[model samples]
Target: MDQPITRRDFLNGIAIGATAAAASGPLLAASMPDPAARALPGASPLPPAAQDAFGYYPPLLTGLRGSHPGSFEDAHALRDSHTWPTATDTGQEYDLIIVGGGISGLAAAHFYRAQAKTESRILILDNHDDFGGHAKRNEFNLDGHLNILNGGTLEIDSPRPYGPIAANLLTTLGVDVPKLIKTTQNLEFYQSLGLQSGVFFDRETFGADKLSVGLERGPLKELLAQAPLSAAARAAIVQIQEGNIDYLPGLSSDEKKQRLSRMSYEAFLRDVVHVEPAVLNFYYARTMGEWGVGTDAVSALDCWGIGLPGFQGMNLAKGSIRRMGFTPAGYEDTGGSFRLHFPDGNATIARLLVRNLIPSAVPGSSAEDVVTARVNYAQLDRDAAPVRVRLNSIAIRARHIGDPKSADQVEVTYLRGGQAFTTRARGVVLAGYNMMIPYLCPELPAAQKDALHKLVKTPLVYTSVALRNRQAFDTLKVHRVYAPGSFHTYFHLNPHVHVGRYESPKSVNDPILVHMVRTPCKRGLPEHEQNRAGRAELLATSFETFERNIREQLGRTLAAGGFDPARDITAITVNRWPHGYAPEYNPLFDPDVPEAERPHVVGRARFGRIAIANSDSGGAAYTDTAIDQGHRAVVELLQG
Candidate 1:
């Protein structure tokens, strides 16, 4: 990190809630020392109200989040290969118990309550300190002004439009997508200041470090002169971006798509278009923002569908095409392609769901006011409420009390703060990671367990940076910078979104929040192979390592803009998810089979009274899919 980062700064300025000193692994044996006994240095620096909280306000907490030190130890223990102990029966029971207090889990409770009796008791358990699952929110208080940005899952976009189930639920939650886009988001705010998107060529990749602003806006020949690129590479990029030559001239649209699906964008660009080797590197990370992988892994069809360069002349009919890696790019497993997000991403939808489920938890009647409403986390899991969301709880074992075919109740055991507690529910919804479900419910059929184990999620990170000022960005006339060689593939000023009591910082001299995205993966590996490798890499990495990389990356990208990392950067919140984006089937790494025979479908089959719910169950990573799966799980359990 920068030299200004000191032990005192870590303790005071950075709100890192690492908590437990012990590594995130299986629970310690009863005779072993308590994990809590080995707390990280200054673990309790934050206010007491935020730790192990019902009043857990994680947005205010910064630094290490999303699989933070204390969050995943219990789940890790279950994943490390043994069913945790279920000795202590809490003697508490619910009509319905939903594992994973994410969007799908919360939605399951909502649907369960609506269909079941009015008094039906529902319990939602989540391992993280906050709800919303991957729909995370990051908040910063800069110079007395509160700024909010998305920590994960930006925008309600899918290749296909939203389905009925997902769309109706959004309406029920009072989230008017079009109205919110108009009233809240100012997409042209930065453009109004003559600021445009730019590409930063790092010194390592290219011969020289350079940030070429207003790409393709002016003469490509002139822009290429300033970029750090060889003459051949520069000429190739210009041709790829602007030339209107039909690469697949003789083939029909469907034939071209079929051919594209079988090959990668890199293959198409290299073998077919015959671009220079350096040109390949330029387009490598282009798909990283959407697919979380390089052009080498993503199919040419999927890349073309999501508007990448080099396809302008292909003239392929604009439609959903099969992808070899994953179908997240253009499928409608969840919601539609709205192209707008709440300031804090889908966290607003989660908050709205919570507000609707438990009126007092979030005090707002409309969607607009919910943005700035102070969540009373204490009111979330009230014993008296029909719906309760419990955080910092990891469900370890979920098994039927008797024969699966005729069981009346399911017993659930979970770990929190290193202690185990058991409870029971008439029906259960497993809305957590599909890969972990097999570990949670061992009594499940062997084939089902095997299928669930195949669901490996992509690991990614969304880093929120609080800058002392965005004057550097203003001076550079850059709204967003795509750094192909940096630790973060993309970094841009926070979207101009303000709702009700919330307002965005408009001054360049004022501190601002910047959002950066990183998807760690090996280039040559298959989609799932990259995901698994990235997962290992993320779990083994430290906050300090992340900080150092982030500092070095931002410094190199914006130094010419007069940005000084040590002085201008105020705070950083790295939301790291080792088991991020729910597993979406990729044809490249998966068996070619019918939709019903797919692993996710076969795995999600209802087991007696226990049904699966999550974006994983639907085989798509979107908020809409999460909602649809939750609704399906509830209907299956209630009507079964």
Candidate 2:
């Protein structure tokens, strides 16, 4: 069973809690470590803050001077530096050593701490001073008003959106989770193309045009009953919900097999509840934007797993909603989409996890106790097999370098700090992008990388802009805009946390921070081939190019919306994750059966140690997938 947060831990928890509460609104910020302070014996100064965090300029950088940026190589150097404590010195061995400090690594650590029976010593190495890779938070003072901005993974389907996870993670770590996932009254849908109108028969806006309807609160049954529909339509919808037919409208030849493998959602929509084509299109757009796949892309059997069913009448579990930081004016507004979040988005959870991993890191304890408990990275001598984890490191090259039988294990060399180093492990986890996987494991026959490369890739550029006035655009009902000509999507995010400008009683002139996200670059096709021996391969491009695309698109949006692009801007920052997200199912794979059971080697493990766990590994990039894989990997080690 998971241990409860002890009383002694409450002191430190309270400090972080107060900090989180203070930064509860939007503009939840995090302190950026100095880039110059990162220098080791021979290592060069690390990149500047802007390079590391997309040039997010909040006041956290004050007096924080460091230049050494942490990378995979740093872990190896820390291991050799004789700093901190380690199991190797105590003659102890661990089952695993997770390299990355992102969700994958943290989840693995959480699982191992809870389940593994092998007396495992979990060591997670991240070059950054803190954890929570992409899911991070930022806070700022826009014209004297405090606000928070989510740097990554802003919205999530947390078991409780505003309770334990959000509150504890943020307050405990001084992160503003509540501000990121801001609570809101309702969602407003806007037409992207002034599409043909439709109708809804039931709920608060009964017997109204779909384009003009706005749904208010009601139970699932009540809401469905409110929608105006013929008896035939209702029955057909019921059948679809009851798992009797396929309702997804569009399906390609290959998609038919995948959809029919289970119940089809299309059958229900056509034969049962009988939603009109226009209504279906609206539903399709919203669902696609949210799930990253068209409605037909999923089986009807899987539909209930997403948002609440429209027919079910807004079925919210009891006592799940909290009213903290919600404004009467925002809630009374006609159109808006809102939720609450912690300061660093998911990084809040990551920080909480790392605190637990450190030895004796209880609340109010001296920094020395925390330091003493830390498992030092240095103590890992090649001869010292007892060392469980070696962080701040990377395996530069791994290969079947010599004769097959005698040299069974792959030879791996890595750089640590400024020095080159070498080591060999029984197995490895290629838990990064698939693009990099082929380069490391070339022994696979048929150039598997090429096939993987053929799969369609989507590029996204996320931007966060904190404004000086929250009410400037309050008159606009729609928070999101879909610009078909320029990028995939754009939205004015309503942060989950309580931004002081939006919440403070004394503040009438607070600046609003509007975070706009879009896709600017072309990434769907495979890279052109350079050699004749093999087909053209796909090469990934830099993130800067992606950001440029977004800037260009934003300029168009300014022109279309009639906003002053130059004058309206107060403080603007851009964060680019070059490899944003991967799509599900490779273009070549059979979707009918599980990828693992199919003939191809997609999403499979080789031998035991060299396991791959990326969003692309499962061919599906999702929070749950990452968590499931992390647990699965831990289980694999435990079973071994």
TM-scores, one per candidate: 0.90, 0.53
Worst 10 residues of 2 by lDDT: 8-17
Give the per-residue Cα lDDT of candidate 2 at 100.
52
Enumerate residue pairs that collide in model 1: 26-77, 54-377, 159-330, 162-335, 162-336, 325-586, 334-624, 334-625
* Backbone clash count for every predicted candidate, in the order shown: 8, 97
| Poorest stretch of ten by lDDT in candidate 1 | 5-14
Q: Give the TM-score of candidate 2.
A: 0.53
C-alpha lDDT values of all predictions = 0.77, 0.37
Error of 1 at 250 (Å): 3.0
